[model samples]
Target: MSADSTHAVEKDDAVFHLPGHPLPALVTLDSTDGSGVDLFMLSLRRPVLLNLFSMPVRDGRVDLPSVAQHECAQQLRSVNAELDALKQQMPELAVLGLSLHAPECLRRVREDLQLRFELLSDQQRAWTDKLELPLQSQDDGSQALRRCTMLLVEGQVSRLDFPLRQPSEVGRRAIELLRRETGTM
Candidate 1:
């Protein structure tokens, strides 16, 4: 569906609501370049693979450790690299990663992983609160958004995977969904 006047632009202050039922002009933070990315605007140009992770991955798991202290930012980087390669096959596909971390930390992780795609930061939980994604209680008495991924075809939510069972399979899973949706493979 083309982004036109039919789709209402939902907004509350700086928070934009992207309901699972499907909404238009989705908005979220894109701290990857120290600027915000309008997901809807971007998707209007092409399909989007939005991966929402709880926190930065370190040593194969999501850990709250300094980038220098962590030996590796596994899981995500591996999946991202795979997905980046698949971009050649799915020309119109845009892969994006969103995490609930500060931009500073995200930058370090991005540099450490040498990611080709953007890794956005949602430090204020603006998107999370609006999405109302499932949350898990942390040992520190705080709640964290569960890791999940969503496929947005032309700015509309198409498919979602909650509490991603296997982080390693993110690329493959997204590829299969995109191929199935776009009939690319």
Candidate 2:
């Protein structure tokens, strides 16, 4: 991370620092549309709400049968709905979903949930590893990223919500942050 990417704020003798690590410039993933997405480049163009999802893996792929019953999937559905509303209000924001699932599986989920944002696949775990995201051990003894949300501005993680407790609150929190940053709130 570059010095310029580091962010901090001071108010009334209190200091708040953002996440220290900026996403690597070379990070890329396969979008559900079958095109390569340069995540760092996208962050440069607009603020990105990057939502990370972890799903059960089976037979070298995300277990499709288990998704419907998975809590993460339920959380994803709520988050996606909230993000859709956020996009309607702020079209400039770039909302993306990232997971270890294959592109085809992500596409199916997108369609099923009527998600408005793009879904990207990190099948090789390269991007997650680079970010050093926390991993959750699955019942099948596989590892998947823990559910989290990141706000990336100009390739730097400005805000992060790890171990997200309320899936429905994510968009509201993001809106509050963006509005405060833009002086619209």
Q: Could you say which candidate leads in lDDT?
A: 2
Per-model clash counts, in order, read: 0, 0
Q: In model 2, where do residues sit more than 4 Å from their true spots?
A: 1-18, 58-60, 183-185
Q: Estimate each model's TM-score.
A: 0.73, 0.80
Q: Give the per-residue lDDT digits (tens) of candidate 1, residues 130-178.
A: 6665666655555655655666666566655543566677667666656
- The Cα RMSD in angstroms, rounded to one decimal, for candidate 1 relative to the true structure is 7.7
**Candidate no. 2 TM-score:** 0.80
* Weakest ten-residue segment in model 1 by summed lDDT: 5-14
The residue-level lDDT of candidate 1 at 50 comes to: 78
